[model samples]
Target: MAEGQRALIVSAHPEPTSFQAALRAAAVEELAAQGFAVQVSDLCAMDFKATLGPEDFNDPRDTTRLNVSLEQRHAWQQGTLAPDVAIELDHLLAADLLLLMFPLWWFGPPAILKGWIDRVFVSGAVYGRTAVFEKGRLQGKRALLAVSTGAPSQSYGPHALNGDMNDILMPLHRGVLGFTGMTVLPPYVAYHVPYVGPAGRAALLSSWRHHLRALEHLPALPMPRLSDHPDALGAGERAH
Candidate 1:
């Protein structure tokens, strides 16, 4: 809520005129009104690469094999990561609040958004042997998922066939964002987006605006803390 505080919204929808775009616009307007500087990364419009490969690194730790984790660390250390990735990483590091916006595909975020994480979240800079959970580089930041789903909200309920939405998103909440030490907020999900009428869409936008306005007070989702599990750091080191 402080002046000059920054918010970055990374949007992954392909269509520029889609409902998701509207949601993003609403967020921008609301956040700006609240005295926060807002930055947007419209992945689809940018034609963001959705795959990580040799090109992502200028200097690889191992030339014979592509070890993504090691290469990411090396590139991060050497400042040799791909240009696009570096730019996104800069934005990510500067943001006080990170909002991942996308339409759910196959019960998860779209491939582009996933790839954004893969490239921008450098292993050494974002997370490392000792820098996980509470000690992560992004520890002071906050992250929230703004997702759109094709199915109705009922289908994603506690006892619904598709399983609870919270359960479906646990990996991202606890593993990716939280793993980097970011405080994860409960997701803002717009269900049955395509099936909803104009009024419903408007209502969704209103709700999103309300959510953004109250972001400072939103409770963080539960996540693992290093102090609670002393062996977790050792386990990570062993895996590496």
Candidate 2:
């Protein structure tokens, strides 16, 4: 909402002409009009390597042995991470608002987006032992998920066949975004996307633009703070 703020949209739709792509493009235009410097990571266009393995590291101290986590930490320290990961990190660090735009697949993000998180949210760099939760490296940043679902909104309720949308997104909003100290905003979901008529799609895009216009005023979803609880695992059990 602030003038000259930087926004990064990580879009994972494979087809350029898809509805997801149209929403993403609309977001760019709207946000830019609101004085945002926008950048997009079109994952499919980039053909981003979704899997992490030994190849991610150029040189290993012990070539015969490999621990992915340890290797990631080492890479971060040495500034030797994969070039793509490094670029993404730079973009993330510079962003004030981060938008993850994708069509929900099996009640979650696409595999390509998941892999981007796995590789780019490096241990030592984005998070670490003491720099997590309330003290995370990305504490001041905001993240919102702009998601699309093939099913109708009615099917996503608590008792619906598709289960609750909020429950399905908890792992991402709480475990991932909140864990990293981002202010997780309530998601914007467009349901029954494929079945929607042209008018419905246009309305959804209009809603998205309105949402962006008031982004700074939107309340962040509540998240538990690590500091609010005791360090001991069974503290609550002991109290009870």
Cα-based TM-score, every candidate: 0.95, 0.93
Clashes of each: 0, 0
Which residue pairs come into collision in candidate 1?
none
Candidate 1 C-alpha RMSD relative to the actual structure: 1.6
Q: RMSD for each model, in Å, please?
A: 1.6, 4.2
lDDT of candidate model 2 versus the reference = 0.88
Candidate 1: residue 44 lDDT (0-100): 98
Query: Model 2 Cα displacement at 215 (Å)?
Result: 0.5
Best by TM-score: 1
Model 1 C-alpha lDDT per residue in residues 1-240, reported as the tens digit of each score: 558889999999999999999999998898888887899999999999999999787778888889888899888888889999999999999999999998999988899999999889999888887788988899899999999998999998788989999999998999899999999998999999989999999999999988888888999998888888877655444353
Model 2 weakest lDDT span, ten residues long: 231-240
What candidate 2 gets wrong by more than 4 Å, as runs, is 232-240
